[model samples]
Target: MSASNQGRIGVLLVNLGTPDSPQTPDVRRYLNEFLTDARVVDMPAAIRYPLFRGLVVPLRAPKSAKIYQQLWTERGSPLLYHGLDLQKRVQEQLGNDYLVAFGMRYQNPSVESALQELRDAAVSRIIVLPLFPQYAAASTGSVQEKVMDIVSKWWIVPSISFISNFVDEPGFIETFAMLGKAEMAKHDYDHIVFSYHGIPERHVLKGSHNGYCKLGNCCNSYNKNNRYCYRAQCFETSRQLGKALGLTPEQYTTTFQSRLQSRLRDPWLQPYTDEVIKEYPAKGIHNVLAFSPAFVADCLETTIEVGEEFKELFEEAGGKHWQLVPSLNSEPMWVEAVAGMIRRN
Candidate 1:
């Protein structure tokens, strides 16, 4: 490749971040920034600020910091470590043609830094790919907004393209299906549950172009009316992966997990993780496996929440087997898949 052609395309991988350290201050800073985003909290700062600063951060930070302590390893937060690995692997696979960078939406190695890396490389074209598989305003859209904010200030902004979502991408489906099938083969599970991260119904409505997202079958249909609906995209993710794994509609179910707060009128994804675990025993389902595809790397949500908490609940509910399908953390195939996706774009 000619010197001038080097770094022609920049691929930026963005994910929800983790604290720089397990300390309370670091965790608090991370959480405060993450929760305060209008897309994430979806309330006026006048109202949400008090709740987040006075109540949520103060109360949750210490506890969450402890959780981060447990999750932190020698390489630091698993999310950051795996993100770095993914960036390296994707860069290697893409050769010298593409400049690859990774960033977290919340904490250290931020979107700003990633864009700066691309800028420093003098990339001619940039592809911003949020690590979120499904399109959620809080996650993917937030990343998009930040990327635009930075690029808009650039004196020489290159051709910029944002990947809206890749829920139905063949490589993505194959990667999830391979992992799911491998997990299933290890145990004869009676039920397979696809538990994605939850978002408030109002967030969906805010992003909806029309009044189409009712948060019900409206999502399941995957039509133009519900195209950008996060809930619908999640269902489509499950449906496509299940079909690839040869799972019958009755053999698997989709639910949302990791809801931090409750809404009276607003609906989140139905059949929360705990409820699904509790009801499985009554249905004669002794074995269950959970796939948290919402997260690209195993964080507290996947490790403690799904692995430990849900495992205990299923065991208490008379379930004999409980397993969690692992996240796609720089697996070679996944690295190739990400590179392929970028190449196609």
Candidate 2:
């Protein structure tokens, strides 16, 4: 690469994918690919493949398709479009010298194609930022693994870097805090919930640095020791947002949601969002605002699951009000935060 091209750095932003459309067949195709990833399921292929394809996808696709329909907008999947816009804005921030591209770990606008775009740009170095603020094997790890698998086959691989996590990034926390503060001012919510997507307990143990995470209160504190622990990072992000928004410990709680079905009774992070919402009413916490910090964009999980289904549950439990704090989505601060991460890397 020439000196001019050497300065032409490429930044690729990766996000968890969505179905190509809000239809059953497309949803099933997406579910099949997403669920079958070894990083995602992590079970013996003999058992995992059969169960995922035979029972799970077939049974769940239609229901999930309906949820996707609810989440669909005029531009289609919010996740994909927001991701695209983020890519554009970050590129604008970096100017013409940097090539900023976006890709999905699965489904449309794949990592492979995005890599090709960077390669075509003839950039000397590449920086990949997985859109998940907190790291997990199922999300960030999977994206890193796929990127390497593709780049390894290239005739020449340029210098490539990966940002594994950004849970405590100041700008990131500030963006979420800004959103939460706006919601707090809008409603006199009785309690606040930071609801993150749930992963199997085993997954945490597998990623634990020398078994540091006991999957207990040790995860409540964030430090170099438990830095990569997904649960710990989630709590840390919550605490930072709480501090920024001037929320008391008694007024807010962190919970997990969207756990997939498993044959074994392995526990995921708790208290479950659905269960917590139901309990809120009985605890005299009638009005609440929930945040899905795991997601940067409103999708099936954040929009349909937390915003819709959880609201229904809380209302059914006699809660007077249930509100969902929207995800960052292409917010100006979030875009700037992402650009900062790329520039810093």
Candidate 3:
């Protein structure tokens, strides 16, 4: 091969990550690492580090560990295994011409290690797919920042590209629409809910295009002004998925989930998943099907938080058959969705 074609392209699949094990220590370590990151906490090191170490990690770790315990499986975390399966599938799909690897933003199978592998392969360029359908600073933003931080240190950095958000990508929509179709066939659900992972309102404003994100009705319609807005992208994801699922505007609701307040009276995204489900019972919506497209893998957030906890909440609020549509894991369609994204990049 000529010098211009000396190296193969590298593809890195990144997910948020999970604790090494379900144990409290591991969970605590994971939480500490995750929350301490400035991208996540979005606080100064002097203030954030002490608060996370002294208060947040100590209080939330044990509870989170139990949740991770519930989320754990013999194959290990759903996020990790599914990511590995995706890596293998994408590699096979692309054949010998390309190389693929999976990395976690925190804990085992670190991004640094994955990048090292790619460097060893001597890939001339890297394509990063941060397994988030919607763009958010805390998720995809953090992943891209980490990748940039790592590769910039290299003596010979290759060209790098990131697929920031694919909220409306055809394969992504197809995979999610396909899952919704199966779930709908199983039950006569009274309502449909699209719950994306929540980020702080401030983060939304920070990424706002020319002060475009008012966090009010701006998310109601997606446009050029709010193209990179997390809230807008989420709403757009729901809109596209709704069209594919044959759902009218009144047939479903878009909401947010898994919010963590960074400061006193600090609000994360509104129309929260928990609050939304509670109101469903009063509206005589007994049965509901939920979709968490922000999460590509069935991790603690999807399987436990959305599937179990929200189901319990909905039931306690006097609803029946609160079912969560499983995430787009390593199934063939999802694999194709992922593979197609990588190949296109």
Candidate 4:
């Protein structure tokens, strides 16, 4: 293709988002927007708004501010910096022909701004890649919804494409496997934990096509039946990583974490990471290595929650050691993977 033809193509990368700063007010603003998203909370505004704004935000913001403070770097939030770096590398790989831009779903460098940049370039087509490896209504789906909502109002809309998920993509799987392998090489851990973000159990059943996702070994394999099921995809991701790392079923446990409050009748994904960690010692698994494949970059969830908070939990439960494998975050392999996806699309 000629340079002109390729330059007409625009690539917009999106991630979940981060607070503008580690300050309590900034974090609260971010939380307010994020938690208020119907897809994320799955409740009516009258109820969700008051519960999150009145209760959750007020109680959690200060504590979350402290955690984000720990994660802030010289460049700012690790998630934001990593995302910016990833955008730069992808642009470099695609060269000047492709206008590769990035934005977050919630906070600064908003999706609206990024879409405006691509629209200003007068590109003929735009490809949106939500950085979440799995397809979740709250994350990848929300990005798509917002993008469409914005572009639908444009006087002259461009051809927009979206990469919803790449959980089973070879490049995606290999990149995480490589990261996990390097960590495993450094020490022999008694167990491996694959902890993904929790979603309401209702979320899974809500989208199930004729009850396909029973949430058992049904997710051990991915097919058209459970293709969009986030829980299934998470399990399949763990399965792929296990094969790459030569791990037997007994050596690893797949669980969910970071669950927000829900009604007693409603349950999120089970084998909750925190609860499971406390039980590891009694099961004779003292040391553990965790992989947060759900995240492409090390954010609060991976850094503070998994690496620090969960590590403390394991140790307090009489466990000897706990280590979290670093995320792919702007790694060369991941950059190539993303570039390849754009080219393929």
Q: Which candidate achieves the best lDDT against the true structure? A: 4
Report backbone clashes per prediction: 0, 0, 0, 0
lDDT of 1 by residue, 166-279 (tens): 888887888878888898878798988899999876787777766777767777667787778888898998899889989898989998987865532466767788888898
TM-score of 4: 0.97
Q: What are the TM-scores, per candidate, against the unseen true structure?
A: 0.96, 0.97, 0.97, 0.97
Off by over 4 Å in 1: 1-7, 263-266
Taking the tens digit of each residue's C-alpha lDDT, what string does model 4 give over 236-293?
8988888988999888999999986354247889889999999999989998999999
Backbone clashes in model 1: 0
lDDT of 3 by residue, 1-345 (tens): 742477788889899988899999999999899999898888889999899899989999999888888888899888899889888987888777678988999988999999999999998889999988888888899999999999889999989999998989988888889988998998999899999898888899888888888898888888899888999999999999999999999999989998876453599998899998998889999999999989888888888888999999999999989888987787787787777887787
For model 4, the superposed segments whose C-alpha errors exceed 4 Å read: 5-7, 262-265
Backbone clash tally (model 2): 0
Model 3 C-alpha lDDT versus the unseen true structure: 0.88
Query: Residue 309: error of model 1 in Å?
Result: 0.8
Which residue ranges in model 3 land beyond 4 Å of their true spot?
1-5, 262-264
Give a tens-digit lDDT track for model 2, residues 53-76: 999899999998988888899999
Scored against the true structure, residue 336 in model 2 reaches a CA lDDT of 90
Give the worst 10-residue stretch by lDDT in candidate 3. Answer: 256-265
